[model samples]
Target: MFFIICVVLLLCYFYMRPTVPRSPSCLVGKTAVVTGANSGIGYQTVLNLASRGCKIIMADVADMEKSKLDIIEFTNNPNIFAKHLDLSSLKSVRDFASEILKSEDKLDILINNAGIGTAKNNRTADGLHPVMQINYFGHFLLTHLLIGLLKKSPSGRILFTSSLVAFTNNLSLKTLNFDLEKPNYFDRHFVYGNSKLSMIMAADIFAKKLKGTGVTVNSVHPWLVKTPLFTKIHAIYKNVFFQMYIWLSQCVFGRDPWEGSQGLVHAAVSRKLKNATGKFFGDYAPWRKPLKAYNKQFCKEIWDASEIYVGLTPEERL
Candidate 1:
């Protein structure tokens, strides 16, 4: 009985936690790119930024015509544009970056918000694990390719959407790319957590390297929100008990997508955080003291390996 009561109290606390409020500052003429903008927190972030008069570029793998229409109609802003970007494919990422560089004069904000939670082991066309490629490597490369444009802005900001699991999971950087010869060794959840950890580490590394360059890099945990990612999990678990557990958790802890997007929005444009960089944010505030394992050495190792994995040329190194 006591355990049940404690669990109930915890659920209530999570449910009632306050979200970051939208910024009142105008972003007129500022340009931003948000990956995975078709749905979930990414979609909400686009709406919030568009409402504030920022010109938005929606980057996603699938067709975003519907989302673009909805955003234009809802925000009453026609500055939203769509671009094709398949994070799983290195070639696609390069092509998307090239087009953006040629077309847009400047990139004021970049939100690397696309991610996936896979239930099965799979490899992308780039010969890396699907989850790792989409969640970490692709964004790593895209950021590097666009650093020039980001630097052109007065105060550029880059935001990565990480997760709370990164703090608790035992991430093995050595096994980032699961060996195809040993397919049996792959664990879906572990790989997913490692990918998120990589994002945090990469953000820290970029922030350090970009010092005095007028560019800020940060990562954020959007909290638990009911999004399409759960549909994949539901398909993986068919047991009655597991299904019930998922339902209970969502009902108790999940916030609406807009509420979940607050931390990301705050990191992107909040005046309170304009000068903050190399930080992890949650609940619309800085998350201090991440695990000691996420050290400078580890971050450097991951950054170097990512450069090779993404085929970043020497000319592109920052």
Candidate 2:
């Protein structure tokens, strides 16, 4: 009887997991830019949007030729273009934005999807924690630089690929940087969670600042996804038991890249959420309530601190 009950529960869990719906709206003539487009959910998102007739810009440090080819062939949309964006490098972010500003007159969607989860402590060329730089600060700077172009559009949407970990961690606004001096400071999971939380907070602040500008900003926790990010975790833990656990968990609960990307696509193109801004989405729908840790004051502090970390000038502060 116990075994039968357990099996029944497992079946129900799998049956109830939300699936991404095909976007009903057409995106002909719309323009979208997705970071980390070379692989994972970003690559899947590019394919979906491209198929709907949206011109796409694939930005990542990885060689995007294969992804570009696949998207072009699968969607038969030749407008897919690639731009080199190394989210860990502030210089690279600026360079990519400059190029986009010069070439593209209109921007409809900006998906800040590139992220890293490193077990080791490392710093980027910008002198900040690598995971924090790639996950939050870099996208923060990129959005600031591209706001002018986004404003030119009739309606612009900004989507951040956040994680469930965001809700599980508390951010220390005083030290966005991990304390290398402390023995417990090198907790990579905590560091990564903090960065993700910051991204969600930043999205909320941006939504308020850009109110009535016809541009909206929101964040989504793409379900437990099977992507290269986990490969990094496996590389960190060489234990056979740990590796086996990862494999088992992925086999049981992980969503494919396409399934994981549904929430992001839904956030970007769904007519129902056209005016929804500063909201958290999960399973292609909004959370019933706001996160308890979401404080407007703390969000402002994060915004100011991030501006300084990224070297934004007073004039550039938005």
Candidate 3:
């Protein structure tokens, strides 16, 4: 069919899209931390930074020993280390930050890259929505805690792995409730979108807060790579043929993970972006603006609400 032919052609084009070459700039003494660094975009981004001689902390819920060893062997970067960070729990996030602050003198890059495609409509023990907690609020707290350490570096950068799904997140303050209180709906897809949108909103707010502090804030969308989370979510419906079709489409059309990570790599390390802040990298040209960003009053309200939800004390407020 003509439609099928066109679909195949489109897949070929995405498959052929050019990859941003790895940066030649070195990060010899700089320290960077990436969550969800065991796999997907986080894994590839860590590899890219490791190749640049950066000391990397692979923070995730997974057992990070093997992943750290693999990167160490491949890049011959001895400074790569693994650290446990379970973003679903606020205590885990705080503990991770505490460990980092006590051990590392400074942090140059912090990529809030850990995220989930679906969270099964659950709530974290902190009484926050699971996807929102893992995708946005957990990073929210982590960044707030590590901000001083980031400021300790001569040039610091924070990057959030937002998603294109943000464009569809038509969220209001009530629906954005972290605790899933009464009158709040729990649509998994929309929550994911809302979380991504929240991330960009945080970047915009942080860019303003960190102004003139030598730290830059940005967010990136790692365009539809071959992640299995959403697929599993839909497969729960038990549709046999549709599941096969899903696998086929992803196999034939998904961007390779390494190529998908280039925009993040560029955002995290490229010298050209040293002064770039409060921006979105929708792709490798590495710049786009989300619709909800820059609305100062609205964003400020969201930030204030987030501070309360995450239980940040007066002293921890940025």
The C-alpha TM-scores of every prediction are 0.93, 0.93, 0.91
Cα-lDDT of candidate 1: 0.86
Kindly state the number of residue pairs that clash in model 3: 0
Q: Over the stretch 1-318, how does candidate 1's per-residue lDDT look in tens digits?
A: 999987886979666676557578798999999999999989999999999999999999989999999999998999999999999999999999999999999999999999887736577767899889999999999999999999999999999999886765455556767554433323666677788888888898899999999999999998878898866776775667767876776777788899889889888998988899999988887786357435777667778888899999999998
State model 2's lDDT. 0.86
Q: Give the lDDT of residue 150 in candidate 1.
A: 98
Q: Which stretches of candidate 1 lie over 4 Å from their true place?
A: 2-11, 14-16, 119-121, 180-186
Q: How many steric overlaps are in each model, in order? A: 0, 0, 0
Off by over 4 Å in 2: 1-9, 119-121, 181-186, 239-241, 288-293
Name the TM-score of candidate 2.
Answer: 0.93
Q: Which prediction has more favorable lDDT, 1 or 3? A: 1
State each model's CA lDDT, in order: 0.86, 0.86, 0.84
lDDT tens string, model 3, 197-245?
Answer: 9999999889989999999999988777775555665555355775676
